[model samples]
Target: MPYATAPDTTRIAYQVRGQGTPLVLLSGQANDHHWWDTVRDDFHPARRTVTLDYRGTGMSDKPDRPYSTEGFAEDVIAVLDDLGIGRADVYGTSMGGRVAQWVAVRHPHRVRRLVLGCTSPGGPHGVERDPAVSTALSDADPAAARRTLLDLMYTPAWQARQPGLLGRSTVLGDPAMPAHARRRHRLASARHDAWEALGHVTAPTLVLHGTDDRFNPTANAPLLAGRIPGARLHLIPDARHAYFEEFRTVASPLVLDFLGAP
Candidate 1:
């Protein structure tokens, strides 16, 4: 329940766990730290994991104002500064990944390593998600939105095994989140364009995605990997948007190796 004050004077809530080299985990779209609930344990004990709710989500202040990936990145840096953490490994997924790009580019000295998952560089050069997917995800009906979000995230087999995943998956346009905040999150994410600034990232980077991902096209992985100097790309075959959670058995070990897990 600890909090940090963003430059805008907005209060950002964050949580810290374990005790080792800091690892910052960023959430996607309109979601909060709960987005990492499933994969967090994979890095526990070996790293001091940090998770936060963006200014518009979770336990943070929800302001009726403009938001951008750079702004979100600043919020993250503010949290780190509050914690007295000078630098740390960063892992961001979906919109969070886009925010991480800005963090690495604008604040190079503060990132030890970077992991971008199921995300895009944005603008014209990036491969965008299908408009239908967006339409379905942003459906006015909460139940329909949840169904679409779950479908886009996990495969049928995976969904079948996890009986109530649809109920639990409430990141994007869930009714629990304020409508204004969700719009802000979507707008902030849509405006993210990091392709031009990616070259400045000096941290060892990993760009990963699920091959079958439709939410954030898998094609963006190679584009990101190629743009960033020395960045590596990994695609989980047959995995969808929730690859990190569905295929953790493979994804976790690979990321752990790259992070030099203790």
Candidate 2:
């Protein structure tokens, strides 16, 4: 129920859980903090997890104005400032990775470590998803077309064992937003251009991706890792866009170790 005020006077909603070293989690486009509900506990008991709703989603203020990854990063800083967290480990996936890029670039002092999953350093350097994937992203109704998304996100075997998780796992849905809010979120993400500024990230960074990710593709991960000094890239073999959820058994411990958590 806590809120942090952004420079534009927007209030970002955030939540904290567990009781150890702080870790801020950024969700993908159009998703709120709940996007991490399933995977969050994996880092807990030894690490505190902070989750927030971007301006256009969940309980945050949805303004009738433009949204940029830079602005979203400011919202994140606002939350950190409100909580008096000087610096913390940051983990972002999908569009959240774009915002995290700015967080590291613009507020380098605020991030002690960074993890980018299934994301890209935008502009001309980043690879685009295939036309079919773009079509699926644009045309599908996330609410009614659950199976289509489930097929796009998780492997058939994983989906079978983790039945009905598509409702909670996918990043494209935000039931609380109006049409314009969703459009703003998409536009901000599509326009993200961090390619030129990634080298400025001072924090130790990890770039992760799923080899079979049709949505963002695996190629982008290397680009990010290569561009950021001292960054490392790790690909989850045979995993897809939702690998953070599907491959948590393989990915979570890796993250914990990278952050030096217990």
* Highest TM-score model number: 1
Prediction RMSDs, each to the true structure: 1.5, 1.7
The CA root-mean-square deviation of candidate 1, after full C-alpha superposition on the true structure, stands at 1.5
Candidate 1 residue runs with Cα over 4 Å from true position: 170-175
- Per-residue lDDT tens digits for candidate 2, residues 34-122, read 87877899999978999999998999999989999999999999999999999889999999999999999999888899999999998
Per-residue error for 189 in candidate 1, Å, reads 0.3
Q: Name the lDDT of candidate 1.
A: 0.89
Count clashing residue pairs in model 1. Answer: 0
- In Å, residue 26's CA in model 2 sits off its true spot by 0.3
Minimal lDDT window, size 10, model 2: 163-172
lDDT against the true structure, per candidate, is: 0.89, 0.89
